[model samples]
Target: MPPRTPAAGSRLMQIGEAAERIGLSIRTIRHYEEAGLIVPSARSEGGFRLYTEPDLERLAVVKRMKPLGFTLDEMRDLLAVLDALATADDEERRTLLDRLGMFHAAAATRVAALRDQLAVAEEFAGTLRARLDHHGSCTT
Candidate 1:
């Protein structure tokens, strides 16, 4: 199959296309914009949000954050930390690195919580399978 095409003229992608590429919904992208986590690279003449490669990169960061159960405010804070790293002085960069470290710790905690939840879910599924095997039937 041929590679997908970008929007005509400019290389920017429309919001729907961007969401599809990132495995997210347009509503989620809009929410991220509202949360000040990311902004569209441009708006088309028809008033649609258009995204560039850098914009997609930002979206990808937010996407990763979501599965880790990061709050919107935490997401915003992390985005600020990332933005500041670009032009921060050494001392400021050190501070940002500290902030980034905090986020990493939080992610680790969340991942552990998710693992516990998954274990419970799998145990429940196994019990159900045992019941099904005992009866050789699946009613309700």
Candidate 2:
């Protein structure tokens, strides 16, 4: 049987499409769901998971956090902060903004570390290329 469409006026998609659109694998999306980082926005009549644009946005956030080496707990906490900010009052918004700032700082530090590692890797590759060039010249 063909896949059932979402209700009229909604743009829900199944797990496979959600994963592709979010640049994640289905298993990764399911893992995030299990970890409470995100949940599908709805389900089809046949019980397949359906996700909305907001759901995919959440997954994109998690995807970004993963490469920065964030733990599941960290991801959950960050997601909570982001969610609360949308509806928070002035005082609550201040606290949530502070939390969000911390996450941003942590991500920046991780990105800088990765750049340093990449620099070292590139230098090593260059060394190897130089050695190969030296050997090739000696053989000629």
Candidate 3:
């Protein structure tokens, strides 16, 4: 059987393109799919996974969360909160918002920690460069 293409004017793309556009490896995307973090928007007749813009957006969220040290379960929970916010009733919306706020706070803390680590690393590199300069200047 021939491979099926996306419908006319559709913005769907195959997994490779989706991975590239989302700045994640194809393997990572597949792993996310296996972890229930995302689902492809469609599949070609040949069984190729296809993704739409929203699918890419979902992957993007996971990508951003990774560097912040969020575990798969945290990522999945955050994604679920985001998904529920769209059409949630007022009471549910309030609960979801609270959860979202907690995630935001956690991310902010993690980012600050990363910044501190980066500063320390940069300082260490600077010290090494200073030592090299001093050694190179010595007359022997």
Best by lDDT: 3
Better of 1 and 3 by TM-score: 3
Against the true structure, what is each candidate's TM-score? 0.85, 0.91, 0.91
Encode model 2's per-residue lDDT on 51-89: one tens digit a residue: 888788888999999989999999999988988899999
The TM-score, computed over Cα atoms with residue i paired to residue i, of candidate 2 is: 0.91
Stretches of candidate 3 exceeding 4 Å from the true structure: 1-9
lDDT of 1 by residue, 68-111 (tens): 98988898889888878999999999999999999999999999
Candidate 3 lDDT tens digits, 27-138: 9999998899988878879999988887888889999999999999999999999989998999999999999999999999999999999999999999999999999899
Native-structure RMSD, model 3: 4.3
Model 2 clash tally?
Answer: 0
Residue 85 CA displacement from its true place in model 3, Å: 0.5
Flag clash pairs in model 1. none
Comparing 1 and 3 on lDDT, the stronger one: 3
| Least well predicted 10-residue stretch by lDDT in candidate 2 | 1-10
Q: Rank by lDDT, descending?
A: 3, 2, 1
